[model samples]
Target: MRREWQVFRVATTYVGTVVGAGFASGQETLRFFAAYGRFGLAGVAVATALFCLFGITVMELGRRLRARTHREVLDHACGPRLGRVMDVAITFFLSATLTVMVAGGGAIFAQQFGAPYALGTLVTALLTGATILAGMRGIMAANSIVVPLLTTAVVFLVATSLHDLGVGPAFSQLAPHPALAPARSWWMAALLYVSYNLALSISVLGPLGAEVGNRRVLLWGGTLGGLTLGLMAAGMTLTVGAHLPEAAVEIPMLYLSRSHSQVVQWFYALILWAEIYTTAVACAYGFAGRLGQLWRYREAVVATICLALAGSGFGFSQLLAFFYPLFGLVALVVLAGLMRRSWRLGS
Candidate 1:
């Protein structure tokens, strides 16, 4: 029973790590699954399965090796020579992801509250950097509080939207654009989405699993996180299908929240900030960890804050658009290598 509870706790943390500003705001869903039209639900299923299977693989691998950081896990998974390559790729992607989260938070603030995006980005960078510098206890404590509130707010908004528009009709309306591919092929879209997210998740999930000190906890935590993401994807699919046009705007989820009440709107804005903070912290931690490993910086915290602030200055939408595809390619390579290693290990 204690183990089961730990599993739930760890899972929430993993879920919180992955479901950052983009997931909370419905922008990621809009860009990935919902963009696929009716087949979007199919994409969601594929993404969920990928999240669960790969998430478990990552956590279990970390548990087996007692990995203290993502570097250890990747080194074991990819072996010495290839692991070096994977390490570089993962670090680069992590930095870009951090930039995206910082930028996304700023965009949400500006779009929803009429604040300057630069101001929002700077504030987000400072808060996230501070939390990470406080150590693992601080990260876990912050996540425990924020994730539940964010999940509840999203559930309320999605549930209310579903009630307004019957599920069947909502899904049916999206049928016209089934199998819409962001890239050249449907398979590529699905693979890119999974690979990109899994690559980024490994840094947080690996160390997180090690911290829990139990394989079962890692398994359950990963499962829970994947399930949460799946449900969020489904909810976003419905919400997007019902009101597709809203997704084109900057703060679609906020627009959805407005339908409920002013209180809900305010609640969601707060939740969005929390979600963004969680993501920024995870990404920054990953980058800082790698940097610390490579250098003898006296003040790692200050260095990380500087890096995040500099990255955030690079416009939000431009950064996301550029990194999203670049990371997808890098991640695909890493995923292929991991799969090959798994095959050999099994054999």
Candidate 2:
């Protein structure tokens, strides 16, 4: 029973870490895959396979190394010198992730509640900081409740939106939404999507591996988590592809929900905020922890979140357009290194 519960926690945490505001909001889906028209489905499939494989490899390595933080595992994978570089990169990326989520929170609040963007961002920052101050316990609790709710809401929103939006005609039409990702091909987009997300998520996942010792638990837990994330990403891509009316908006999912009904829109708006908060807490915790043992962990987390909140003043789409590709390219290098290292570790 304990083992099963641990598996469930790991899986939910994985999903929660990956399905941030940008993801649930549909902006990330639109840019990374859905914008490719029908070709995006192929990208989604590729991302799914990569996600499963990568998730297994990361957790397995973490468990074997008995790593408490991403730094130890990364060092083992890349060796001291390059691993140090990767650590710095991961820390920066985590900070960037928090910034992106803050911006996403602001977008959600302004879009849904007629609240000021900065106010929304500040609200999310405070919530995320409080949660991170509690350490991993807070993150696990947040993901356990928020991830399930967010996932259920996403599935419902997508299903109902599709029923209203319809898919067949969407595929039949070749209208390219102005908001599609800039990757030249669907494959490139998929690889980039998986790469950057892995780079960002490895923070929490490293600790996750350290928290459990069962090899079967790591394997199945990681695979199932990846599969869940893939399904959500694929479903959102398909839904938004069919209904690209809100492709221009930062929170496409919210836009889609509003199209169906005011009640659904308001409900998902709350979910969007929760999604944003989960990722924000995860990123902030991960980033702050990597900086080493400070006088207090809470102090570290507060500093990190404040930095992110300050940096998040840019608009959501603007940050998505710039950061996802740049960090993605870097993450691919890291992923390749990880694959190479893990191949030998398994051998």
Candidate 3:
């Protein structure tokens, strides 16, 4: 019973780490999957399989290597020279992702509440800076509560949308919005989606894996986490597909929830904001921690938050479309190296 509980906790954390601002906002889903129409769901399926395969592989390697950071796992998977290259790339990507999250924060505020975008951006930056200065305890606590709420919110929105549209009609409603899609095809979108998320998640997952007691826990945790993410993605894809043009926004889920009721809108908005906050903190911490005394701790974190706020002006969708795919391409190299290493280990 205790072991099972531990597995669940690990799974929850894994899901939380990946379920960031872009994910909860529904923009990422819309861009990667929903834009493909019904084929998007198939893309979600492909992403699910990849998420499970790589999620477990990463944790398993971390256990074997006793990795304290993603750097260690990268070293074993890519060899020293390539590993150093990846380290710099992923670290830079982490900071860029923080900027994306900040932009997402502003979008949620402006789109959902009609608030000033800069107000939202500054609020998110302040909260993230505080959490980082205080330490990881706040992040863990926030994730514990927010991850479950996010899952429930996604399920609720999907079910409500389907109920309104009816099954056959909803299924028929899906149409490819290629202009909104980040990739050229459904398969490419799915691969890029998983690659970028895995790249971001390894910062937390690698260390978590090293701390776990055994391989069994890592296997179960990774499987459960990957499946949970798939379920959420599928739900978001269906809901957004049913709603079409309305889903074409910076905060699609929040907008969809508002069409149902003000209460639902507020509930989803708060949940989304919380997720955005947690993800921003994780990215800021990872970036600053990696920098290691180029400046004082407070100075480093504050500087990061300020940089992200400045970057947020580019707009959420634009930043996400540009940065995420680029990071995904880099991460794909890391994934290929991991697969080669895994095959050799098997042999």
C-alpha local distance difference test of each model:
0.77, 0.81, 0.83
Instruction: Give the per-residue lDDT digits (tens) of candidate 3, residues 302-331.
Output: 788888988999987788778887888889
Return the top candidate by lDDT.
3
Error of 1 at 123 (Å): 2.2
| Candidate 2: C-alpha RMSD after superposition | 2.1
The C-alpha local distance difference test score for the whole of candidate 1 amounts to: 0.77
Clashing residue pairs found in predicted model 3:
none
Which residue pairs in candidate 1 collide? 11-221
- Per-residue C-alpha lDDT of model 2 across residues 1-347, encoded as one tens digit per residue: 58787778888988888888678878778877877887888888899988888887888887788776788877877789988998888888888888988988888788779999999999999999898777777898899999889889989987886676576755664345544666888899889889888888888887878777688888888888889998998788887877665555767787677666788778888988898899988888888886547547767877887898888898776876677789989888778877887677556
Clashes of each: 1, 0, 0
lDDT of 1 by residue, 1-347 (tens): 48877777777777877888767877777767777777777878888887887787777777667765678878877778878888888888788888888887787678777999888888888898888877666677788888888878888888888888878878776732333345755456767888887888778777776777776677778788888889888888778766876555666787787767777787798888889889888888878877877664336666776776788877777887778777888788667756665554333
The full ranking of all candidates by TM-score, starting with the best, is 2, 1, 3
RMSD of 3: 2.4
Give the higher-lDDT candidate: 2 or 3: 3
- Order of candidates by lDDT, top first? 3, 2, 1
TM per model? 0.91, 0.92, 0.91
